[model samples]
Target: MKVVFHPDFYQVYTSDPAAAKGRMEAVVKVIDPFAGFVTAEMADHNDVAAVHTEAHIDEVRRQRLYPVAMLAAGGAVQAAQIGLAEPCFALVRPPGHHASADASWGFCYFNNMAVAIASLKNRGRIDSAYVLDIDLHYGDGTVNILGDKSYVTVHNVDAMRRDAYLREVADAMDRCEADIIGISAGFDNHMEDWGGVLSTGDYFEIGKMAAGAARRNSGGCFAVLEGGYNHDVLGQNVLALIQGMAA
Candidate 1:
């Protein structure tokens, strides 16, 4: 798979776990050997403004997070574009699922998933999209930005049990019909992580389910990094998803 990434992603911009040192490096170490790396670009100003208020953009700039956040968002666009032809994974940070259009919380600045999906739509690359946010938390920001849109549907897996969660993903994948599928991949739900509900292999299963859906519908599929902490096992979890999707 083509992994959209940049070395600058290794820079830490905040005290949050998502911005901690070595977080990007951790995932890179595991994926680098098996994946091709592509340098990320900055998102267009208009693209950023499309889903975020000017105030939100200025606030990110005020905090010196604008560049990195935009870069991550750009990586998401790159991933989505790459996905149009084949599955891709974006290893980025300042996880963006919690960021709404005008306000952001939970260590996010810009909603990367929203930015990617919207950019794809704006370019007339897809008629409809299916987003499976497998984050430990609900992708309220993604939903807030895209829910009302006629061409996109968002589903966040919320089951507490491992089996139930896998079933939920399977069910969603089975029912989806779209031009593309996006996974807001998060690892915090891993058994060793904060959520402590899912195991590492569960991510692989989720990725496989998304890949199966894309195959069934003849659509594209991609993923972007989201709320995964636990640096010790984060790499394995991410690699699992990439392998499954690429499979």
Candidate 2:
């Protein structure tokens, strides 16, 4: 697996836990030996503008988050594109699932998943997409932008129990039919993280199911960074997902 990342992602851009110090480092240290890396670039202004309102972009700039936010979005796009041939993961932040078209919260600025999928669509790289957001919270921002699109299906698993959650993911993957699949990977749901519902091995299952779905569809799959605050276990959880995807 090729992971899209940048050293700048190590910078603590905000007081938010998503951007907290050592958050990126924890994940990187674990995955570095297991996977190849691809440098992330800042998203083109036009690409960012494609999914975000000018007002929203301006607001991010006003907060001095434009650079890092755009970089994260770019990393997402890179991961998505690379996924066309093989599985990839964007180890960048701030998490964007809570960000909407014109408003953002949950430590997000631009909707990185939306921007990347839209960029692929705009470039005629893919005819359809499936987004599986395994975040602890709902991916309202991703839905707000890509939900209504006839070519996309954004599934934010709402199941809480371990069995129910895995079943839901399995069912979704069984039904998935698209040119590409993207995972809004968030480890906050880990037993040691904020949500405390899933285990590290559960993440591997999710990733395997997603990769299997993509393979069944004869398409591609990828993931991007999201919420996972427990530094102690965050790296292991992320690596589990990556290993599964690579499987």
List residue ranges in candidate 1 displaced over 4 A: none
Question: Scored by CA lDDT, what does every candidate get?
Answer: 0.92, 0.95
For model 2 the local lDDT of residue 244 reads 97
lDDT of 2 by residue, 1-247 (tens): 7999999999999998999999989999998999799999999999889988999999999999999999999999999999999999999998898889999999999999999999999999999999999999999999999999999999999999989999999999999999999999989999898898999999999999999999999999999988999999999999999999999
Across residues 74-187, which tens digit of lDDT does each residue of candidate 1 receive? Answer: 999999999989999999887899999999999999999999999999999999999999888999999899999999999988999998988888989999999999999989
Please name the candidate that would achieve the greatest lDDT relative to the true structure. 2
TM-score of each predicted structure versus truth: 0.98, 0.99
- On the 0 to 100 scale, the lDDT of residue 66 in model 1 is 93
Model 2 misses residue 22 by how many Å? 0.7
**lDDT score at residue 200, model 1, on the 0-100 scale:** 83
